[model samples]
Target: MQEGCIEWKLDEKENINSLEELARHGARVMLRIALNDEIKEFMEKGETLRDEEGRRLVYRNGYHREREIQTGIGPIKVKQPRVDSRKAEVKFNSKILPKYMRRTESIDAFIPILYLNGVSTGDFSEVMEGLLGKGKGVSANTVVRLKAEWEKEYAEWRKRDLSAKRYCYIWADGIYLKHRDEEDEKSCILVVIGVNENGDKEFLAIDSGIRESALSWKEVLLGLRERGMEEPKLAIGDGGMGFWSALREVYPQTREQRCWVHKTANVLNQLPKKLHPMAKKMLQEIYLSPDKAQAERGIGRFVNVFEDKYPKAVKSLTKDAEELLTFYDFPAAHFQHIRTTNPIESSFSTIRLRTKKMRNCGNRKTTLAMLYKLSQQVEKGWRKLRGFKEIPYVLEGMPYLDGSRMENAVV
Candidate 1:
């Protein structure tokens, strides 16, 4: 406790001020050792302090380049040792290395792993092993453990405070995750995303199976309701069987917008490969028309023009015509944002690629964990995407939505 004197003790001791003193207090008797470089340097410069024995001594300063070579013991201050004039030797000893140094073989040794966009643990390991030196830091276990934490963090993130109604629009779309079932086969996992009132996004739900059944979608919607999302003013998604049914059951008043992009893809799929160019042009004319009426007119003309050669394409188009054009009645300015589920698709594309590497998810928990982590990671860096700002004016054009309230309901 004296000034300039080293005080040492174990971390539990809570009183030690120096490593040397701590070692001294331990069960094993050990001398506190230190090289006072400055004192040694002064001594090398012909400096001497009289000792009890009164012997002339020289202490040479040692350093690893610019770094000071430091070692010490509790302030008992033993006489400095003399070095052999013929042979000079210096040994380096580290008091303590980072804890990560101990578990070098385990993947978890890599702490505070930099989670990057479009980067995977496998890819990161490859970069460390192939590009950088492999044995320098953590082992395989460290990497797996870090990934497991990410997955766990993601699960916790999904359950975070969603009780408040800040989201103006809740767009729900299912991305099909490639998975395998009981027989060790391939299957699909449906992952849902929600755009909050502030235009921020989050994972709404996740489920697995080949079919996105009504029951499955219903459960997802109900879960959202239970999680504090009472109802959204608008629920936009690609029209799937149980998807709409779930919406109706959960929020009958929610406005629906069918993804125009999916409809276009389906329509294009129905056309022959050679006619894709022509079909694309026709589809564009309908989608990009000046206004809702004009777009509708364009579709009518498209069907008439292609009826003979591509009857099936036109039929397919007709089936999804209303849903595809759902955004039309909303507001012309909002068309860009509501036209398609492309925003959700962008997320799906990344999810598909990440999960695609795995042959099959080990279990439902594992699958959900990965999706939750991946989605949360992506959302963290997401910016508020610009949508149709002019749509408010268009909404004013529709007298019904523009009205003070729809109070005619008997219920």
Candidate 2:
């Protein structure tokens, strides 16, 4: 073995304690080598970069005095590499490990998520201390400060310009979150999500609204317009009267498509509890039909069976008949995507639980800000729309008939 080097065999067996020891040993070894590499690249300027003495300007001096730094796995002792520069104005600093950083950034990041996920503030100190070491836990006051920053971030995001924004399609919905008190339950958050020409989906708005009313929805739509959001090619949402009314006023050119999932749920609500299983199947057949004509026929079958005894259900199903089948006029690859507002619904399924946990935690503005921050986190995981290649065709006003692109046909 080399006098100043270490090696290991992967086939060696070890216990948990030994494994942790091995991890600590590995951290020290890697840090030493990485620091040395940083110095090697700093010595040159140009082809004739060296001094007349033909010597490189920046050279390694030695390791800084060792210090124990805190990490997720536990504290590890490290010695940063030192650089002696002939150029007095230039000095090297380790971005990987700053001079005063006693703890890893991961520890700081983990604390807030822990607190927000139902860990009470009082218990935060003990929980973090156990993981990062004694005296390292952040105070509850610190958490409060972090939360204030959260509010400011969400406020700034609300006013961002959208002058260059355009979406092929959008999904709008009003989500009612339950609170500890009944009065708080009356208010709902209105969400608008749009997919740009690149097919990347993004949140356009998340504002507290008065139960999806026309006036409330008008503000969101107007805000999007004020920020220069262009009219989407189509908008998919439930049979919300307020949203449709607002859409007409702001972007009448954008066609409407009713969410089949919500419409089916509404139709079943009007039927007998005993008939739900049967009626639901009938409703599915309508939207799941292979083509617009077949889907309309399926709707006919449903109305014929229920109209005599269930006039209300029949009306509910037939009222939005045209909008419900609008997906057929777009790319068949997007039929499942456009037939419903599942993009918004699926993205928010997790937020509903967080909202429930946060019941009575704060007032309307604060609550919304927290939701905005959390949603921004959730937004990171959203995937692009399926069949994104067809987005250009959608934006160009290419005609579609029963999910087939009719390129040569007239509008």
Candidate 3:
């Protein structure tokens, strides 16, 4: 054995512990090494010990320290350790322990934690510190700590989930926000949510666009089909010609359900503030009517009552009456779910609120990664939302679903 060097056998745990003890036996080595903020994080988190595969090895709490000195034989080899895991915690706090600390093995603890609080990065940091603090490896700048893993995961996620599968219904729309990428131009984010056979909604894809153009929406929808989505039974969206064109290009047979909420918003925008209540009442009669015939009658009543005073509003309402009530054709049971794209809208609100803190995205990939992380958060707590329970009953006369028919339907 060299006088000032340490070596160990791979099979000897006792020797390893003894070596650790020897390193920390005397004066504590408190050498500070410069590292990128991220590497420093690994030291801070007690995640410094990693396997050859780069996966973190838990329960090993030792960090490497290096020193150079002029010795009899030039620069002598020196490696020392200060504080390691063998030291018992001098103190403990029951109230300070983070709940997420227990799930150390999970690679995705951040998602569920952030989702619970309904906050973005800054808020996410505050909530974590508020609950857990520094002891559990919680940091104020968590996104910086998570950059490497997030990048890797985002890349893998983009390439992994590919399938040319069909959906029963897909809700598609865009959320606009001001992102100061190169300049503070209005940017639109495209989101698509697919409804599967069991009436479960799954997020399919999201993309950013300068303007909600036909070209951009078409690219997004085309990318979806290219990734895995096949023909859809229906595609619900705001009645943008671009959205319709994109849907048509992707799934020729899919039914189009113009978002009722957006159309109503357009109607209400034209009315004066005081007249909104009356306008809403008139619009409700059209939308709430049980059948197309009754809805038409309601529309007639609305026009007769408001046309002279609010010709523009009446004309807009009458123009969109058919598209607004398309949900009625798809069985009364499915009406509530299909009338608007509220599910996707709610999901967007979370993402927007989270990212809006930053003036601009770091880059396109980071923007996408943030959105993906937020979506994963939503999915973590998501329950299978109950759809039209009477769907089977509503379609009773339709040929009974045999095994082959059912298989074909899903495919």
Clashes (backbone N, CA, C under 3 Å), per candidate, total 23, 0, 3
- Sum up the clashes in candidate 2: 0
TM-score of 3: 0.62
Full ranking by TM-score: 2, 3, 1
Candidate 2 lDDT, tens digit per residue, 1-411?
988886754324433357666786677667766766666565443224457799866777887888888788777888777777777776777777888787676665565445434466677778878875688666788667767887798888889998786689999999776533355654888999898998888888989899899999999999999988999999999998999999999999999999999998999899999999999998888888888889899989988899999999999999999999898999998888898998888866765667466634345665666667666766778888889999999999999998889978886
TM-score, one value per model = 0.61, 0.77, 0.62
Residue-level lDDT tens digits of model 1 in 46-133:
4454345765444343432222111222122123333322113322223222112332221222222223223444555554544223
Local distance difference test, candidate 2 = 0.80
Best TM-score goes to which candidate? Answer: 2
Candidate 1 structure, TM-score to reference = 0.61
Off by over 4 Å in 3: 1-128, 134-137, 140-142, 159-165, 183-185, 350-362, 388-411
Off by over 4 Å in 1: 1-127, 136-138, 180-184, 351-363, 387-411
Q: Tell me how candidate 3 scores on lDDT.
A: 0.59
